[model samples]
Target: MKVSVVKIGGNIIDNVEALDTFIQQFAQLEGLKVLVHGGGKSASALMKQMGLEPQMINGRRITDAETLKVVTMMYGGLINKNIVAGLQAQHCNALGLTGADANIIEAHKRPVKEIDFGFVGDVDKVNIAPLKAFFEAGLVPVFCALTHDNQGQLLNTNADTIASQIAVGLSEAYEVSLKYCFEKTGVLMDINDESSLIAHIHQGNYSGLKADGVIADGMIPKLDNAFDAIGEGVAEVQIGKAENLLQKEFIGTSITA
Candidate 1:
């Protein structure tokens, strides 16, 4: 059995036309598949309207008490439903979910070290039974970036981490191909030059790429997560533009174990 666990971030979701196009492309992907999506500016935009200033540190949102409510509504309710509805329009049956639903994903609050990232979660487990059941029912599971403590409290989790963990968990039953699709056309030697895209990366060369400063900042964690997933039995991992999602030829940076 083969499954493609594709994750699309804020860049695609924020754009109306881009999301619709991606949904169409997602419907075209072969075999069993799952979609993990991140909330864009919608949550923060709604927060601002509600007189709450969004806070962030090192590219991660600071999900406080009030912020958590907005995220739960925006991520789980609005954004998730829209994507599910779009998939339905494409004749693809997508079931929208949160980690809280079906107890699909379990996570714990991040212990405070220096920064107190209130209500943020680090994933602890991915339950594959429901996922497998969903797949058998011909349903594509669409997940939002919200997890729970199994104690009724919802926590804001990173979407990339959620995707990686889910792929690793699903690897037990399927030959998994995990994809981290975003705005860029893969890992670039130069963020400005698309031609500088690095088409391949593996454990052997990853450290060197970081030493050369080709991979840094936010991209570093994403690559680390990809490598972690690959090491944990995921057959393949790729990072690239959402535009190239359905292409038979993967025109993106392939990460290997």
Candidate 2:
């Protein structure tokens, strides 16, 4: 059995047509096992609408007691369910899950040395048992990054980081490919030019690009997660558009170990 795990960005899910097209392609794949991780754009939007200001420190959402509740309810509840519904509408048997399911993932509240952000978590361990059962049963497991400890306290995790961790876990568990799908085609040499997709990336060069400001801001964390995934024995990590799927000719950056 071949597995391909895709991490869909929250921004991409906001666009109706793009989401539909992506789901349509996913529906067409035959004998392919998929695991999806999505984010909390709509959840944040609702929070803003309700006059609950969202705070961010170093690009990670700051989840205080108040914000944590909204995030868990929105991301793990509404957003995850909607993604599953979107896939199911296209006849994809998708099951939405949180780290709580079958103790699928475990984490300790992240204690940052430089900053204090309440309730944010760094994934300590992923229990892949439930995931194996779902995959074996022919169900696509879609995940929200929010997870809990043994005492059952909900904690926030970086969606992309958690996605990469889950991809790494799935790859280790099943020995397959993990693809990071997002809005950008790949890491670009020139930020403004879409055609400047760097097709092949060496781990050594990625560091210099960041130091030189070629890869900064959002791309910085994303590339960092990609490197982590590649380093952890995922066969290959490609950052690309969902439209291209697994087509060989499609342009994207490939991270090879």
Report the C-alpha displacement of residue 52, candidate 2, in angstroms.
2.3
Winning model by TM-score? 1
- Each candidate structure's TM-score, on Cα atoms with residue i matched to residue i, is 0.95, 0.87
Candidate 2 per-residue lDDT, tens place, 60-131, comes to 677888888887787788778877898898888999887877888888888867887888777888877778
For candidate 1, lDDT tens digit of each residue in 1-257?
A: 99999999989889999998999999888899999999988999999999999999997689999999999999999999999999999999999999988999999999999899999999999999999999999999999999999999999999989999999999999999999998889999999998898998998999999999999998998888888899899999989997675688778898988
Residue 8, model 1: Cα distance from true site in angstroms: 0.8
Q: Which has the greatest lDDT?
A: 1
> What ranges in model 2 sit over 4 Å off?
30-32, 57-60, 112-114, 204-220, 246-249
What is residue 71's positional error in candidate 1, in angstroms? 0.5
Pairs of colliding residues, candidate 1: none
Residue 39, candidate 1: alpha-carbon lDDT? 92
The TM-score between candidate 2 and the true structure equals: 0.87
